[model samples]
Target chain A: MFRPCGLFDETYAKNIAIVRTRQHWILIIIGLFIFLTFPLYLSGRILHFINLLGITLIAVQGLNILTGFTGQISLGQSAFVCVGAYTSALLTVHLNFSFFLALPCAAIITAVIGTIFGAPAMRIKGFYLAMATLAAQFLIPWMVTNVRTDLTGGSQAMHVPAPSIGGFVFNDQQSIFYIIIPITCLSIFLIRNLTRSRVGLAFLAIRDNDLAAETMGINLTKYKLLAFFICSFYAGVAGSLWAHWMRAISPDQFNLMESVWYLGMIIVGGMGSVIGVVYGVLFIKVFDISIILIGPRLTSFLPPQLAQDTAAGLAPFTFGMIILVFLIFEPRGLAHRWEIIKGYFRLWPFKY
Target chain B: MLLFVQFLINGILVGGIYALIALSIVLIYKSTRVFNFAIGEMMAIGAFILYTFLATVKFSLWIALPMTVISTLIIGFFIERLALRPLIGQPILIAIMATIALSLIFKGIVFFAWGSPIICYPERILPGEATMVGKLFLSNELICTFLITISVFISMSLFFRFIKTGLFMRATAEGHDLAQASGINVERIFAVSWAIAAMIAAFGGIMLGIRFGIGIGTLPLVAIKAFPAVLFGGLESVLGAVIGGLIVGILESFVGGYIDPKFSEITPYIILLLILLFRPEGLFGLKRIERI
Candidate 1:
């Protein structure tokens, strides 16, 4: 928050408000207007990327809550996303449920599963918990492949019908944008409120020091499970969105590597901040998309096979390098960088 | 009963390889508190180096093995100096992330060099036919893999027991501060452990490539399989790692043989979760009581 010279807060509402000043509110409105209208001038490909960004933002938000706030690390988040995707896909395909109804149901189912897996967290922490979550990463996909192949489509890609309401199909990028944007906004809004509420405080407490937090009357098991439930819920919702957007689902889509990507995203962004999550997602996803688009073009001089291999390798190589650079140099992530930039502008030409 | 025995023998052979990989991970974790997520990638690198020497250079197996081990040691030393050394005093989680990043970097390099295809070693290098043991037939490569892994593990055990550097490593694992105060070069020990672990991984990688054919994905999967063993044996115990590897191997074999084969893939992870739930420190790990 920036305050001009001699500026003062006269009321509790003004002092505690997230949107502190009239200018802040105006900027927020402008930001929302631009975000909502982005599909109007952007290309279909860009819009597709934006839709992907929206979904990832939701999933990474869950990670921010668990890892960022609650101090619990999950390497199996992709598994929960898979659960959500498969659940939503299975529901829409088998029961003929609408996408609107199936999305939340999938998230709820994923939350339940997450909670069951999270039960072990009270007993194990750190690397051990990571292994536990890693089990989720391996086990969920195995189950999806092996059990009731009829429902899961059995290693075969299951087609997801476009979410339709009253014969209006959301098959195009713009239509999917409409369905995705509102949910993403609402999720961000809800999570923003969540981080400010008592529950959010509890999560922060647990993260800072769980033993101390427990001594201070925080129910470690209950809150830990809650964090898992919420985090996986977000992952599930994102998975459903991704499935419906792509119109196909497979077990390979939610592998351990994807889970690592999400981890890298949070680390590169600010771990505990919502704005940080957005920055991290945008930076990493744009880089990833560019690698997919530009890698082949850049490596075309090599033999066809070699070029293809190099192009495929470029994404991971770049991601690995970026993560190492950021962790070693800017451990606080892009959000911290943003704060520094803002601070510079706020006090331009004035050494404070 | 004979059939069961045959599967048991097959599993032990494979388990030896798992044990070697697990030993590398355990060594790194013991000395430096950093879980080397990239151990599998190191295995792949080691295997590829050997593959180059044997397949492209047409060197004899005897000549290729030492070359691979030396190359792996240099690579491991560079990795520690460049990637891991900076992360020494940082948070444990950050160090872990460094390994994860290193894994991706190594994997990307390997993928670029080798592509995705499985590279076969020349048949003349290792015997192609299986040898009969009583009523059971064991493949020649499996026998070598078993013997090589056992020999490596036994040597490592001896190295830790009697060698001065090994004793320093054990002291470092016990307490870095105390080790440093006692005139042990902890940083050097950390680097040495990484180098030794890398060589072991390379050896295991070569053995696995000989048995299964060298592939980009083979060692990473094996590395992940090593996790259950690490957890089962306690992350710090060398003997525990070996025993854990054998147990996981036998369990996997039995599960594949008696139950569904698909279940075999996940049986180790299931056992890992069970052990974690009941004993988070692991079966052979020393439990530290935390005082708030």
Candidate 2:
């Protein structure tokens, strides 16, 4: 909220505007332009990465609202995403529903499932709640794999048809980028606005102290479950995008480790901040891609027996090390650092 | 009736190891208030270290077992000092995430050292013969495991009841500031708890290795299976952890035998969800009263 010394808002509209300064508007416009036109200039590999990044960003943003904002730690987020993916995949494959129709249906179903799992949150809290959600992580996948093996393809990969809009097929990464990036932008916009609303304030209240929030007459049950609903909705959207993007789906795609990685992303980014979600997802995704790129080269320097293990192990090792470093040294995360840097710029040439 | 008894006995034996692993988790949680998510990896690494000594270096069991315990204790101590100590006053989420990170780091280390192979101990740690109780056959390895687990329970109980260090740990668990005020080194207690927890995890891992052969894939899953037991017994209750482990193990055995083999995998988590809904405090855990 810090601004340059000479910029004062004379009107309420100008004061409340998210894009307050001319520089902010210009930066937003230019950033959107570059992001929208990326496929035109960037290589296929980078575009593919961006598409995946965009989808992951949506999922992490939802996580920020739940864990970061509402103070409920869900260890089963990827499981919720799995529900969305499988639901969307099944709707298209069996029921012959349009991609457009299936996406929302998938998201809604996932939200319902998430809410059901979150019902236990009403009774338990902290580590116990985490364990309850952890049950969802295991049980959902088990159901997907074993309960209806015939329908779900039973631990085997179920092929998802490429999404099409009246003969314009989104068969490749570049085409899917069109679907992923815009939705990512819209999701960012909605979540940002949502966090600034009355509901968002209620979420913040509960997160800070649920018991206190209840004393303040903030309806705890409604908001907590609502947060879970919205969180899973975002995951459902992301999962649907993922299934369509990959052209195949499996229970393995959304495992417990992926759930942990999502939590790690939000933590690294800074919980309770939307821009932080962007920073966190981008940081981790880039780190992951770079590791994959560098892994073979780094492994070649080691002895052959050690090489294979190093190649496989380095990514997780470094990832864990980074999370540990962040938790220890920068627990407030990169967003807090960004705030400090912004403050420095705003108060330029002044010690205060 | 005979078949049911056989499954029940088998369940109790396997449950003994589950209880041991759950105890490791409960120990760290009680002392430091940090849920050690890396418990599975701790168990895996301990088993691997034992495997290296017994199989790779061909050290005698006498030397290898003690060495494994010492190395794991050091690992646990350094983990607390380097990773967790800095985040002491931070939020609970940060502490939990730290353990998750530790789990990943430990997992990566296990992968780096052992790769993916299922390695067996060079010699059998227990007798292989199954003793027949009428028509029900009980394996010697399992009976020994149950006896060892019971002895461990006894020793741990006695240690907590009688020993000075154990008393300090109890005091620290009750309240950090209060313990420090009473001349107890709270920091040392945290390190000691972690060390002991790691050693216990190693014991569970070694016991499991004796039964199934140590594999990176399966050992961690076993720890996860123990989670329900931890929850069922109550997070803070050693008795609860033991009883919970036995119940979950028996439940899994029955489910596997009667219902389906696959259902057994998720039975613990199902119980976890059920416990959270009906009795979040667990059967033996103390019910905390929150005040504003």
Best by TM-score: 2
DockQ, every prediction: 0.67, 0.78
B1-292 in candidate 1: lDDT tens per residue? Answer: 9998998998887788788888999989999998989988898889899888888898988898889889999998888988888778876567877899999998889878888778877755676578997999887877787787788778888988899999999999999999999999999999999999999888888878877778877768877988999889999998888888888888899999999999999998898789888988877898876656
Number of the top-ranking candidate, with DockQ as the measure: 2
Cα deviation of B173, candidate 1, in Å: 0.8
Second chain alone, TM-score for each candidate = 0.96, 0.97
Q: Which docking band does candidate 1 fall into?
A: medium
Identify the runs in model 1 with alpha carbons over 4 angstroms from their true place. Answer: A1-8
Model 2 gets an lDDT of 0.89
Question: Fnat of the models, one by one?
Answer: 0.53, 0.70
